[model samples]
Target chain A: MANARVIVITSGKGGVGKTTTTANIGMALAALDQRVALVDADIGLRNLDLALGLENRIVYDIVDVVEGRAEVRKALIKDKRNQNLAFLPAAQTRDKSAVSPEQMIKVLDDIKAEGYNFILIDCPAGIEQGFKNATAGADEAIVVTNPEMSSVRDADRIIGLLESQDLRGAKLIVNRIRMKMVEQGEMLGVEDVQEILGTGVLLLGVVPDDETIITSTNSGEPASMSDTSRAGQAYRNIARRLLGEDVPFLQLAEEKQGGIFAKIKKLFGG
Target chain B: MLADLIERIFGKPEKTGSVAKDRLRVVLASDRSKIPPEVMDKIRIELIQVLSKYLELDDTALNVSMERDEDSIALVVNTPVHRVREVKVS
Candidate 1:
């Protein structure tokens, strides 16, 4: 807990897979033998619990812990699958105003005292009070974005805001990329997003769009637990990178095109 | 319909990815500077008024835009000057 790294996973735009990224990365970090505590800071719109398949296990929420109704440990729900992973769900009946920045800092401090090596806060969308509360106690940030114009623009805005708050060196994670679309020039590539966002934000990892992610979410199982899922492998790599391991990005283009290209070439008799 | 046919024959129109990049470049310049188009116009008009007191300017050719680079953003102004106004000593 003394050297625990408090990182907030955020994006300025909604529906860019912030909660999914948080759940998967937390699971991956736990798999790597790190003590991980995932805090859902979305307040009323609580989904990290469901994503981690721990929604039914949460008895006390963050509001209860902050309001003195329950202790921090009592509010935290340990992942049934992974002993190293724990989660604190947000209050479903409250809004963003239910918790203040100071209270969030205190809550994180409490979680840190529980001896977690990594405390990942799943930040809510928008540049509002929820965002502030999520980032208040964070030492670093992971900005998840989609390779789309609107998402990239919002990410730029978030980077600027984070810099103004003196929270510099926030890493980027471009999620839900369709490699074929990037190769065909129909979607924005990672380089275009990096160029538009500037170089201050470093690249953390890129998760490809995988249909298994949806199925895993629906089943309350994180995709990171799947060995065959491309998105899952990407999240696992991101976790290793967080642990100071140098893991190269997955060769997504080749993996996505190899089979199809071979078939096309054979059909052309080349 | 002719243009559409030509585009179809040409194997598709311009890639929208490049178009998005171009649009983002322009929009981000203004977004980063915190200056909207109306504010930019106001700044241009005020600049013209201040410069007119000392120099004769060609307003038609004047240009003002926020230019962005990898490190910084600059309010680039290209104001063509017609002539310098002579100052009279009392």
Candidate 2:
């Protein structure tokens, strides 16, 4: 029916790519001509604007709209690249309680009226009130976490929180993965994450660890806009999966040599 | 089934996978219960006190264990039986 779907992307712990994931996904959606809005729910540590390259234009924010200091449309900053994408920045001065959960719901509903395919909430780190405020209005949740121990631990807690809500569906998107490390038995693979979470991941995409991401991020350009970037490809895959497409995971390494495992199987055939 | 599940859940953790799953599971248990292992020990002792009034039991008989089931914990008391005695009633 073209009604907007609200997805709060969160990991209970910090620095696991919540804002970056939200930005890339918003960019991907907008590229598909889907009207998308990314709401930065991280009030205190707000950086979605910097990541999206709209930091200087933030004259109004979510707190402004919530507290009646500004109109919702006034605070909405259209993306420099896509007319279909807009960002509602979090207020830097005020804290999380500056806006209540009900206020967030009202904002989402107002934005939906202007016609959008999706509304993404860039939830702050931790299981605190900010997280609560971010999630309270969403129909579904996309739990973002790294394959690392601390990230997964926080993800588990976030998963439990999602289960407590009206969960349209909760999907897992693992970020900053190196497939070579996974193949070499140096890193955590997708299987390990799924088992501990004890659920089916609706969408699984691996953003490879590339220096390009940090460089582009620092320069205020999303990696998703660059076709050659590996991290962009991963986010693109996730966007396709979100739209209900079946795409295989990225094979980052050249493993076509039919290695020792294949030889062992052939030898057992006798 | 067990082997398939083992491979599925643990996912052949080279290093990161194992650490991630282990850390997540441990944290999740506490998150759901809102009670750490430290507090659970005290709760176990209190539970044993009530059980002692009904019957004479050893430590083995009074084992108190908990399992995480989604959002709640399933608590069980495993009681060992050495003798079944009936007191005389006039």
Candidate 3:
């Protein structure tokens, strides 16, 4: 088996759906038969476990593993839904300072020996010590952002930080996009955000703003696990793309009009 | 929807997206260059003050900013000097 590739999901700003993206992507990847491990690197503000609905199953966290109080295997919580998936929750009582980058590296190195295909680290918001610790052991980075100014700006900063770390190029996942708003000129379109952030950075995927995400989080099941939600399909597409599959982008926006309207639009050179 | 499509195809000339693009370009350029806003403002003021000693110029017409391309960042300063005045040296 190949060594697990550590990837960190990060956004410089909070509440931009980093945790949600991490959970769904991990779950989706696991569903693809890849042995995946999701690490909650938020430290004191732990939430990835909650997003995974494994909050109640945590016995030992990362801090305990780093402190040598618990073995790495003991600290890892296997997902009930997927036999190949696992989680390493962060300590809730301790802060980011409790864990060192070297410790994280050691823990991840141990996890790699267990023959995982992917390791997804859920980084905390902001470019602080927590972010530093999260990205320390990661080999690649995925930046989650909203189709807005503040989120895009912060994502730019995060990308710069990732570049400085000498890690692989950071790919973007634009979340919570409202196509109607873009069509109405009320919000930035995907192309607009891409233009501002620079096209040199690759785009991994886009997730539309779906009401099912809220319901999924409330129920402790990732939206991607659902069979009928568009957001879930989007995440699944992202997972497939990550696995080197050429999946076409989903057409989330409805068609503008019918046969006559389409003909008119074409005639207008639209 | 047809109207919207036609407008988009021909273009309504909506400046919202373009405005954001322009603003983000300026902001990201400065951010990537690691130049603080206050420092940039100070540099602009000092450049104008020093240049005015020799040339009659329009301060409002002056523009000091940075631009970026694929490879490098450029410092562009534009001072609209009306005319060059003759001076006698001892």
Candidate 4:
């Protein structure tokens, strides 16, 4: 009966940017005046803390909370940048099997009762025990994938599994889209991915491939905090959409020739 | 530079996105069915064994694959029957 909406950010293939998405989305939500908690469910391969620059502050983790070694409040790490944001680090020494789905549910239930507005779980790659544990108590899901065949294939598999789990159908986030490549027809476009992924899921948002994301991650400052970053702005729009706001998607690329008339035509055609 | 700019303004580049789209369409269809590529090979072998008794068929001519559409998975099996065995006179 808790009011918190628990959402899991997942991708079946590794290195498809699940951790980065979780960190950015959590930071963006927290910036919007919501109490946000990011749970790193990768267990042994925990890196969400590093993305958030909270690696040094982790004395206790999710495993410790589940095992009763430390209280939940003691294990939660406060974000230096945002007072509303908190992070629950994962145990780097233990494997995914150490945490069960039931344990994950219990932990989420406890976090929900603490008055968090949103809980974003960073699920590990692969459709294994780690994935099951991370998604055990999620009310909705956000499936992340790149603009390549391998990532999209894995994402389709993950979507199939998520639908069968009886939770709300997943929202799709096509990440790392290079507009140049997409225009050149070298990479899959957003519409192409949506067609192959089917109409069962809604398109949450599209994030362009931006270098600012890498720079921000390296500096432990989320791009969403920067007004100049294109990827950061995309994430902000997504956050607004999640809050039920009618925000227009950002125009990342511009046409150089026939600009005004072409813009009108494209807008009407779309 | 002028030619390149003109091409940018008007030329239609070779559509490589369609390549990714086509490849993903087939691969994801097969993947979501939970049947591995190796399992399809196994099915081909078993199917040949069962069909070889009734007709003389070319072993290399058989194909077993999952055809995927927007929402359904269809198991397609194609094999050419070269010659059927004639029944003996009673």
Q: With candidate 2 superimposed using the best TM-score fit, by how many Å does residue A91's alpha carbon deviate from the native?
A: 0.3
Deviation (Å) of A232 in candidate 2: 0.3
lDDT tens digits by residue: candidate 3, B1-90: 999999989988765756676677777776878777899999999998888877889988889888777657988998888986565556
Q: List the residue pairs that clash in candidate 1.
A: none
Please identify model 1 stretches exceeding 4 Å from their true place. Answer: A253-270, B1-12, B35-73, B76-90
DockQ of each two-chain model: 0.57, 0.40, 0.31, 0.61
**What TM-score would each prediction reach against the true structure?**
0.82, 0.77, 0.80, 0.80
Off by over 4 Å in 2: A254-270, B1-74, B78-90
TM-score for model 3?
Answer: 0.80
- Candidate 2 whole-model C-alpha lDDT, 0 to 1: 0.81
User: Which regions of candidate 3 fall more than 4 Å away from where they truly are?
Assistant: A255-270, B1-17, B35-90
Count of clashes, each model: 0, 1, 0, 2
Model 1: residue A182 alpha-carbon error in angstroms: 1.0
lDDT per residue, candidate 3, A149-174, as tens digits?
Answer: 78989999998889889865788899
Superposition error at A129 for model 2 (Å): 0.8
Give the per-residue lDDT of model 1 (tens digit) for A149-245: 8898899999988887788999999999998888778888889899988888999999999998999999998999999888999999999999899
lDDT of 2 by residue, A78-178 (tens): 88788999999998998989889999999888888778889999999988888899998898899897878778777877887778776645898888877
Model 4, which residues run further than 4 Å from truth? A255-270, B1-14, B34-90
Please name the candidate that would achieve the greatest TM-score relative to the true structure: 1
**What interface Cα RMSD is found for model 2?**
2.4
TM-score for chain B of all predictions: 0.60, 0.45, 0.57, 0.56
User: Model 1: per-residue lDDT, tens digit, B1-90?
Assistant: 998898888877768788888788777876878877898888898999888888899876779987777757888999889899996747
